[model samples]
Target: MLWPFGTTWRPMRQKIRGTVDLRWLTARSWTTKWYPQGIDLGTWRGRRTLAVSWFRQDRMRRHVASRIAFVDLERSRHLDVALAIEGDDGELVPAQIHAGGLAWFGDRLFVAATGQGIWEFDLAALRRVRGPIARRLAGSRGRGWRAVALVAVRTRVHPVALRCSYLGRVFDDAGEPLRRVLIGEYRADENGRIGEFVVPGGPDDRFERVDLYTPGIANMQGAVRWGDHHLVSQSDEQRAGVLWSGHRDSLSRDRIPLPIGCEDLALDLEARLLWSLGEHPWRRVVRGIPFAQLGFDA
Candidate 1:
């Protein structure tokens, strides 16, 4: 469960061998290089695979673009570049999405595209039909749907979805407003815009809202669901590295060290590892941390 990091922490036997090394890949040489903001591991056609999304910035125009890429976790090699989705073409189709987070539920991939909206991609279709579906609620405009963190809910049949946001409101499966919990401080009137909403829901139009985050956090960056607990991470202009836990009703006002400066986070559930990407020119470095040693325990 733990790896030796100098003399700071004790070493726990690892099931997988080889030191953790981050490999960088590029499709083109732009001013901004792509970074791995989020990742998901799952099985398809009896083969294990890894899915990743990129955070990019256009130095010339100062514009930002988010793209999705996949690699074989079993093989640890990048997937065919053609299959990866960039900007609106991938999960955030029809919208200019900047992916902030990602998670897996059953065989489906859920991605959080800050400002644009959340998307649910069919893993089977990615290999079968080569496309995903954007599950938009009726009359919903995808407002505050960005900055999403997805968690798997325990239930019968398929897993449920849980989403949180930088803005206040949380939602159930039907996109109905749910209660809110504390995230952090807010600046603008709409700074507390809801980014993601997660709750217990079923396939038959039945859903229930469980927990929510209150407005205040300017921008929610990263989130992870461990067992029944949810850890949300954020940063601000004054301070950086804020972590909040929904399952424990706790928050860390102090900043923590992050591999990259991003509002998004990804978790490798099986390995109990966390992954983050840095900003544009520095996107080559992907940071990995152990979940068991986050220091915020319930």
Candidate 2:
């Protein structure tokens, strides 16, 4: 086993399947444009689905297209409906690109961008929905760094403080936070298009900088909130997936192996299933493990 972390795969019911689309291999993050980034259990077009965020659209060839496709999770044989987000101006092509972590708050879906600020959309219409939102979160000089996962909880989900009950994270592909792995908790701000990240992990639980991953956990991808904790998917190149679970303040935590480079994670708590999504789901998707099998009780 090449894995230096824990080898004992926790006992949980596992189910794996994928939609056999003859499309090219895409839907990953920090590696290719076809790579997908985030996953969530929500409704699309008024139908329940396993929502997955694609970095850029793969119209056989990669281009400037962003999307949030769906998998029919409620059905016995799930259907994959891949739709590139269209502009509100009535154009049928993708209006934006470079999408990352996604979270739903009220009537809007908040999407993290690599360079752009968070993009909001009205799920039912499948169109770009921008609100009259602006905040002096970072004054004139804003942080244009790339962002990853997000969490918009009604209450403080984890043992952390919050400004607006909405927390988001940004990634560093420039190799700045890779060695130390910036694991800090930031407050919610309206610094749109991949909002600015500020350090506010509090005094006792503050983690301005923490040394995580001695050998590194590949390129940091996307994440999702599980109960009071967050599970971050660390892409092992583009072949395998490693999941790192912990609170924002806690860095050194559990490393659970997953299939393909799961750009994001979605937990179906009712079924005790952990939906680990990767790129190339149009071709194949490897599913495994339950949320409880990770040795953590919810």
Candidate 3:
């Protein structure tokens, strides 16, 4: 049988690290309604922070909207942050969309709001608020409400044009910041695509480049480009996920087995760790794999 991307799976070459179990937050109807989808790491107020986006589902499992979990590694505490936008009356209202993926750039978190566009939230502007929206996924009864991260900006992409599934950052040759974010789709078709765009840049300078994988990987959940090689995660609900490494030519590529429901990728070049998360119901975690094991000398 032919695989869609004509890709081959290689034996696992690396062991995962920094596993943070997310199953402990199963109180109320939270886990039953929302499932994890994306993960990224960054510094918040001088503390190392990990953020995971969760898309909410109704009783029938239909996508309802999304929220974000801000994890403080040192404290081993996770705070549910509600995603919201400013309404016409200047009131903060829920930004209803599947927050498929998240990429942390400085204090801004780029969220892949599938079919809507990339939504940017400022970490410095996080505010504590009380309401039904905030308490919906609080995980604890002590807190009547949760925190809210307002949308600072939204670079809209026509639904048909690009339904972003995941986001990654691009660095210069010296690994210096490029101020650009990589956006990718989750289409299972032959023409699945990914693109690089400038963050907080000019209107005409949005899209830097777009690439379509001819024999595209089905259910591509996350993707990131480092130097000449591209690392991507593809998921199949029935089996374990796969992390594929390839180049622009698509001539030589290899894959390693990932946990079932692996959803997004975030690179910590300084620590030489590649972070991702499992999205399966009741069995979810945020973990990292070292760069050396992934064949990255940098």
Candidate 4:
């Protein structure tokens, strides 16, 4: 069993028993087009597929017309555009999904837009079925509501959804109360740069403090679940890094060093490897690090 400096995993068995070699299996580049900020690996029709959202320009005109697409993992090909938001005249509009936080649940894709709130798309229909516009609270307190981070949890009834924000609220799938996480009192430094307060997990099971990596900034770009802990990618305008934490009430955190220039992350636990999706040309890269190498026993 590989144990980190401060965290532990049960069963304590080493999943990958030998030294792991990391390599890039394939690379797909986008010409001038921008890929969405998030990616997830799942089996579709018995084949592994990489589902991704489309990126949009920051200008207002471009923001209202964006599209989302998916890539087939096994074949290393891009799938057709799965979902597109359009204006009343039927022109495609851009969704405000930030870089690296899209999620897939069951046969659906969920994305958070700056103007559209939380949008849910059905895989079969390739259309958005619902959005969480009403549930969006007013953007105040110097936080931007335009960005969102999502984690999907499976439940007996249906898949439960959890979302985080630049401000500090965690919401359920229906935009209901999961818990309000306190990120600490925000204050400006001498240079007027904002410094975030370090608050750990609260009593609520739905919310956990996640600022150890990117300290004051509240941008949690992406996350992947491995056993009981979730490895998260957090970044600001200049730097990016990774952090891990067990689900709420456990309060175990392990911060790991990620390869530089990694914009998004996905985990293949069965293979004991981690994948990184880079920006711009949108190349898919793989780094095989043994589970034990990460300081956790199998």
TM-score of 2: 0.52
Assess each prediction's global lDDT (C-alpha) against the native.
Answer: 0.41, 0.41, 0.65, 0.37
Q: Which digits, one per residue and each the tens of the lDDT, describe model 2 over residues 118-208?
A: 3445544322221111101101122334311111111111222211112233324221221111221221231211112333333343223
| Shift of residue 120 alpha carbon in model 1, Å | 2.2
Rank by TM-score, highest first: 3, 1, 2, 4
Leading candidate by TM-score = 3
What would the per-residue lDDT of candidate 4 be over residues 46-79, giving only the tens digit for each residue?
A: 6665555445443353432234434444444443
lDDT of 4 at 37: 53
Clash count of each predicted structure: 15, 13, 0, 15
How does residue 193 of candidate 3 score in lDDT?
76
**Across residues 89-114, which tens digit of lDDT does each residue of candidate 3 receive?**
76665666788888887766778888
Q: What TM-score fits each model? A: 0.55, 0.52, 0.78, 0.50
Question: Which one wins on lDDT?
Answer: 3
> How far out, in Å, is residue 252 in model 3?
5.3
Report how far off residue 235 is in candidate 3 (Å). 0.4
Candidate 1 lDDT, tens digit per residue, 1-298? 1112111111112233222435554432223434445554556445555555655544453324444445445555443211123244334222223445555555545555443334445444332121122212111224443322111111222122333222122223333323322122223342543223343244563223344445355556665554444555564433334556555345445334554344455555556555554444433344455655564331
Candidate 2 at residue 251, lDDT? 39
Single out the weakest 10-residue window by summed lDDT for candidate 1.
Answer: 1-10
Model 4 regions more than 4 Å off: 1-35, 58-69, 86-100, 114-116, 127-218, 236-240, 245-256, 259-261, 280-292
